[model samples]
Target: MSESEQLMVVDEAGQPLYTATRQDVHTQGLWHETFHCFVIDSIKQQVVLQQRADQKKDFPGMLDITAAGHLLAGESVADGVRELEEEIGLVKSFEELHGLGVYQEELRLPGFIDRERIHLFLTDSAKPLTGYSLQTTEVRRLLAFSFAEFARLAEEETTVLTTVEGETIQRNQFVPHPTDYWKTVYAGIKAYCER
Candidate 1:
């Protein structure tokens, strides 16, 4: 799908502003939940990371919080578990994932306000990515980097780092979360791994 095409929005803004899903836009807002994962390999002290697909409409090709995706309108947080399995082929149960917490953020554009609450999780899976499906539509590449490297890269605003892909990070400069969220998560994970 082209990046400009919204899943649930009207092309021509009219009175009362109806959603593309044929619902009252004002009465019904798009509710979203994304799974933000920081797959860790406690044994190796590494974290699994993906370079988002450049074609992605939002945050294209940025170094991001491991595997993440929005929960479809009808999907539940439990379904997010399936997404992790499908996107990265990790055979894990919900109990295996540690609930890091929820992150709510507002991404406002001229006429678009995407207010989202993401369900964050963490897991330890040091397995290699050789047999993993790339899900080209959403993911461009996968590489495991040390948690310290992630902390370093995210500590500084908009920096380039090498992936296990060896691509020299051709696209998407990763920036720190303005609220120090990433750093905090990193510290927590580091401590857990240390234990």
Candidate 2:
């Protein structure tokens, strides 16, 4: 098991309050900062997604963002760029990322209380599927979906056939983020591509 990490706790308004261990933050429902990155291959109209490792404590075995992780105590949002390299072996400078804005979300479950302010970003990558080096402990594999198909499934809230690691899968296999969240992410990437 991985040791608990220290995180910078914040208030509803996103002001830093204090520091606490990752376990305590989730257990107490404290708000914390997190970074989320979405990789889009606009030219190919595809988005990269990662399947969370089954051993993960939260949302294990779920398909999630291209890269995401918490901000350690005393670290700024820019420091979060490390997640790209750590989780998916994508080394990118902060300047290379396009900020998509922060989103606040709270999820309460039986043994988890996750309140997070997510600093979202969008990046363009033409790298092939085989180029990513998966952190076996955090991510299991990588997959891609066309923007059109993603929007269609998100709008219908229904599953669609897709490919994952050369295997056919359903779109609902993704993390169950709120529909609006998916819309916002889609719009962000669409706008970026348009620019």
Alpha-carbon runs more than 4 Å astray in model 1: 1-31, 109-112, 162-172, 175-179
* Cα-based lDDT for every prediction: 0.62, 0.85
Clashing pairs in model 1? none
Q: What is candidate 2's lDDT per residue for 125-185, written digit by digit as tens?
A: 9998789998999999888888876665457556664652346666667776776777888
Best by lDDT: 2
Q: What lDDT score is found at residue 81 in candidate 2?
A: 92
Error of 2 at 40 (Å): 1.0
Error of 1 at 17 (Å): 18
| TM-score, per-candidate, Cα-based | 0.72, 0.92
